[model samples]
Target: MTRRARGLSLLLLLALIGGLTALLWPAPPPIFQTRTMPLPGVLAARCDEFTPRVEEPAEGVFVAIGYDLANTIVLRTSAGNVVVDPGMDLARAALARDALLARSPGPVLAIIYTHSHIDHVGGARAWISDGPPPQIWATDAFTGHFIKQYEALRAAESRRGEHQFGRSVGPELLPCTALGPTPDLDHAGSTGARMPTHTFSGLQTLRFGDTEIELHEAHGETHDQLFVWIPARSVLLPGDNYYAAFPNLYTIRGTSPRPVRAWIDSLDRMRRLAPEHLIPSHTLPLRGRDTIAAALTDYRDAIAWVLAEVLRGANAGRDVDSLAASIGLPPQLADKPALTELYGQIDWSVRAIYGAELGWFDERPEQLYPQQDAAAREVAMMGGPPALLREVEAALARDEPRWALHLLAKLRAAGSPDPSPELNIRALQTLGEQTHNSNGRAYLLEAAIRLRRPVAPFAVAVDDELRAGLPIDLFFAAMGARLMPERAGAAHESISVHFRDTDDHYVVTVRRGVAEVVRGEPLPGTPTPLASITTDTDTWKRLALEQDSAAWALLGDHLDVDGSLLDLRRFLAYFRRGA
Candidate 1:
């Protein structure tokens, strides 16, 4: 072949290769970087220094005034004012209210909840004192979502939540970040949460005076999440959808499986909007269409990439632990300010995706029906409790707190009598101080505190207004979860509760330390209840939830008892009343 012809062909091939590489390469990082804000501290010492400051991200949007963790967005529309995700509790709500009142004395016309989380909706009642009770709006599934969490997993969630938020640990011992203001753990549930007056399914567009607002239901952080978009201003209010740090696909505190794919799709939907100003619930807002687009695109790609890697490993027969260790964000994506592991770790995302796709079983026969106390038994065989304690102490002395914690846990589970509670407390304290993850630090410190003293039982305290509105069945289900099997003493007792107000009948049967609630009239063949109690719904709630003395209700004419009073007292004794 001629030299000239061959050179021309080689140039074309080189050009084609360069074009493919450009197309396949990860998008170049955005020219403008998103600003990084200091993490907030919930403890009193650092609370003042780390308290979140309120700022107007856009022309009319104010954020971070109510609480440090959750953002309260106050937008002044043509008609009046719109408040989004009020605050964590009454105090935080008051802070938000004062901040809003200072800027604009106008009344609030509407309150919009991004989701049903307590931090988002707990302060609803605080906003109602002014104005003609602003109309509250939320996703249609919000109420059902709240009920499911409260009824099915309240006990477990409450315990984990206390740890995740560092409620029990002092700031001097364990300094946590991004946890907003410290919440009043005891009075949290007592705070009012106004029910949504208006609910929509998917997309709802409304004209509040001259401004047109669009609400789109997007499932990401929560199943009932909704993002607000104002096309005229090009402002996007994504509640917990696009935060500063990495998205929390799986919270260590334990939560229902979040739909990772749906979460990615939600980000994609926001990216398509090309919002000029993006104000999220947890962090400072971002302005400029190009910047917002790039950030959202990157966020979506990060989540999708992690999920893809996890699925890839799963499909290749890799276990969850292996996937967690192997999968991570590529350098280009990981180094982004918005995608840092401040809140969520990539390892957690891998395990979450793997669990969501393939479920609990890792296709291993040994794990299918493994012995319940396998770890404890194995630890026992390895040298009994004393030996395990000695090893744990040695690990702690060597400055390997994580390893020490693991060994300590196994020692305790193996019924170890050595190392005492004091030693365990010291180890946990060291672990808590050394850990970087806020949730991990909180968990370890809280464990140390529990070892030092008896922790109080978690109380489910619903506001009076909310409690009155809830279905009777929900109340009974919550009560069933609080039953203490040990206190029941193997007695099989059945009690029929007749709610005169609602005309609902429920038979609660306790057998072998398990409590089961059967709705409707008693079965014909079932054993007759030992005691029958007739009460109003309010009285039932007081007895079941508020832990009010049963004698007071009977004397107050709130409850009427038939059959054995002693049997009724015995039945009630099974429940552990919180202080």
Candidate 2:
């Protein structure tokens, strides 16, 4: 054939391929096409008010009134009662259990946790009484994940957790709403979580008498998260997966990177269920399948939209800060009552997505090396402490409470002497009242209280049962994040922690001002460990948790030390206690 004829034939073939690709390109998932429904404008205004009221959405399912930030769901199945996510602590859990039993009296058959979060599982003990305990059910990852978070960051989390839940502020200053009637700041680390008798990985159908409940694992807020579907009642309990606010894609209190793609997919799965009733761990239940569907669809789209915008900017080589500043939810989704930013802000979600995709680095060369705290350094350079105090006063005078707080923080970090503690306290109080986020408000209030008066030492209250049950590896892992690199001194040291009870051994290494904990015995060819401590697990827990002083432990001869005792003392000194 002639060259021109051959070219024409090839063009035709290419056109045919393009046509097939277009046809099979898979239409955007139905969730993406969901139209935003108008929500009641008053809903946003009343979102924060918490008035506990028990309601039965289904024939046998009873939800204890919103007592705190979390809800307890009780299902009266033919076999017995199944409780999902008992409240945050013993008191809260007991309250919920009592309320549930009042409505439907029956023996507890099963207890299910949506995720490993303390608020969801911390009240598990409330369900147990003299009778045979319910068969606890949770995702297989729940216990491990729970141990990793609470054991490692208990102190730091407890401190920040108070602020996150607005426990520092009084009802007169910051009225509690979504966090229940009263926020228990002191018991943030209390772990009432019971061991799951039965654990499952993916989808599992459970039988509670004649009722069939389906559990599906979906990673959204937490990796161990699972949602329940009572097919018999056409009811869906999404736990934290779907609440009456914008999803907390990124919690400011700090968390492992939440899987956005998986979260969106989870929503899709819930939508597919077409439940006539939808109940979340937080907030009120929704009735009608269409309403539940629309709510879920809108929520999924909101998350998708934010993720897409972040990705678009990320792919364009724009930095995270730029993406966060520019990306926002479309007006339709933003205006929806169910998609409000009452709990989780939109900007935070953007930053979280960026961090999840690209990590802590913003692709800037300047960020490669560790730098001193920029805010502190700035305060120091700009006329030192007095100048910053003046600036803070000026900001407060202009009703710029947030700016004033920021300035005061910088001044405090710069080691400035307290020039006007009362004034600083007032400024913080003002800022706390003005902020909308519960966590932010709590932080400001707590700071104010600190400035005005002596603050108590932070303590983590973990029950003996819970502490003893945690894996030895988790204890070491928690230490890794709490290491105070600045206090390590100019020394390279390594120590092996041998738990006599568990027969678990780990090597804790301190080098270049950072400490890392590794499981198993020290590796060959590594620097010789300076010390090795052979101790029972309980003694180790006491030492690590700072419940017992290191000096006391050493003096009491609770642990056997090999090699330089001085080195071990110095190594233990490297971590900040109750940080």
Candidate 3:
């Protein structure tokens, strides 16, 4: 070989070795180490509200505080003991139960769920006794509201909740989850939602033992929410309606439009009750008729003012972003202890209210068809990737991490390979440290870690105990939501499913790009399904949730497939779960 050719080959070999070493080498640690920062004075002071204890708001009324994200209230009466809001999970409920039982050993005559929230009702089974089950009571809309959460929005909400509750971040980052104690991420709890046996609409009164209970439908955070009023005791248990923090007119975790107008109305109703003792499902209890009345009045006015401001701004043709920036409580309301922005902030509530009132259209044609990609390219070309990186660095130095994040996004979208994960991490950490809102703080810090490494989609496994309470229809409905339309391209097939345990039958049809689910048998003119399967509800949940494999279930006789197993596997592949 010629000497020149030999030298070219040697250079190529060196390049190949360098490439392999680069690929194999471990990445260096992040430039900035994330540490838990000290909480601001206001947030630090709020932590005291969540200290675990049991307090009596009135005679014979006991509230187990800080047991979970919610409180458990036990009302002792001559007839028996009444339990209000069992809390988030089995262990916490059991702990609260044991503590309450130690104080009042009377049999629990009734269990009242203020609303259908998991934190309020999941621990109902833990309150069960061998003697007889306590009658569960809730508003008539409870079941429908409960099903809506578990079915359509399940996966998305779970992901958002991880941030909202600071589940993905370290405990030190969140000393208190605003309404409750720092989320116990180390211990997974069992959900025990016992469906309410009795339901009411509008208004209903019940006499349990010697205690007279009035259930009034008060839509606020949830459509099915209700506040419990005991006439004799002059005590009111105002569920999630009146917590110490500003009412979550909009939760960052996401929800259907909360009834802000109705929320204000509900607060008005509480003020009218004139209860000497006011115990909430979250935070500490309030006593004294005058004090409780004043708190309720201020809370109501705060919500009403926010709603009015959003409606006023929206009607005046102002954009949503501008509306959010401009609206906040007046000093009289902002200074009130009951109207703090710990849990929910005014800006988020402003946007939510605006959207709910006027819809997503902002009257701008350019916004109608967002030219984000075109804009990103234009931004990238303005100064190129190097210039953008310098801007990000400068933004970080100026303590403007949010601006740094915006620049980083443009860099990433431009497809630039600027090794700036360290820059991104520092920006996110700075933002998390500076944020006063617990939800935003957690999300920013968690995003920093996720930028450095792959973060798994948060999921809660379907256990046998929890599965029994779930409606079989939810699993099938969720299957449609989990469908991967692209993967199901050009595929049109139907599978008939029968659950022996619940005696429920469903027809799941994957047509082109959508999964359509129909309950019971098919209509007379319906086309014949491609396959049929028989399984118990529990086994189906396990299979659908990917906790158990279809192949294993078929082989173990846990599932009976009438058609080819290969075909069944292909059908299942059309859907995906998690984030």
Worst 10 residues of 1 by lDDT: 16-25
TM-score of each: 0.82, 0.80, 0.87
RMSD in angstroms, all models? Answer: 18.8, 17.6, 10.7
- List model 1 lDDT by residue over 1-579, tens digit each: 333432222221111000000000111122113212223332222334345567777777777542635778887788888889887667667877887768756778888999887778877787887548788888998887766655646656666766676555654544335435445454454566777889998999877777788899999999999999889888899998888778888887778889888999999999989889998887567889898999999999999999889878888888888788878898889779677666777898787888788887877778878888877788968787777778777887897877877776776666655457767777777766655556666677777776666555444446677667655665665555567788875777787879898788988777777777888976564568977778897776655553454556655667676676555656766765441
lDDT at 512 for candidate 3? 87
User: What total of clashing residue pairs does each candidate reach?
Assistant: 1, 2, 0
Task: Rank candidates, lDDT, best first.
Answer: 3, 2, 1
lDDT of 3 by residue, 460-501 (tens): 444565566656666655666677788897888877878887
Per-residue lDDT of candidate 2, residues 1-579 (tens digit):
333432222221111000000000111111112212222233325444467778998889898866656889998887789999887777667877888899989899889999977678778877888898788899998888776545556555555655565443445544454434444444444547677888999999998788999999998988889999999799999988998878888876677789899999999999998999998888788999888899999999999999999888888888888888888889888779777666677889999889888887877777787566876788868888878878887887898977886787677776667788877777877765566565555566667665555444343466676667666565555555566667765767887768777788878777767666677866664568877767787876665554664445555655666776555556667765444
Give stretches of model 3 more than 4 Å off: 1-36, 413-418, 457-465, 499-504, 521-526, 535-539, 542-559, 564-566, 577-579
TM-score of 3: 0.87
Looking at candidate 2, what is the lDDT of residue 340? 67
Kindly report which residue pairs in candidate 2 clash with one another. 48-177, 68-180
Q: After TM-score superposition, what is the CA distance of residue 10 in candidate 1 from its true location, in Å?
A: 94
Cα-based RMSD of candidate 2: 17.6
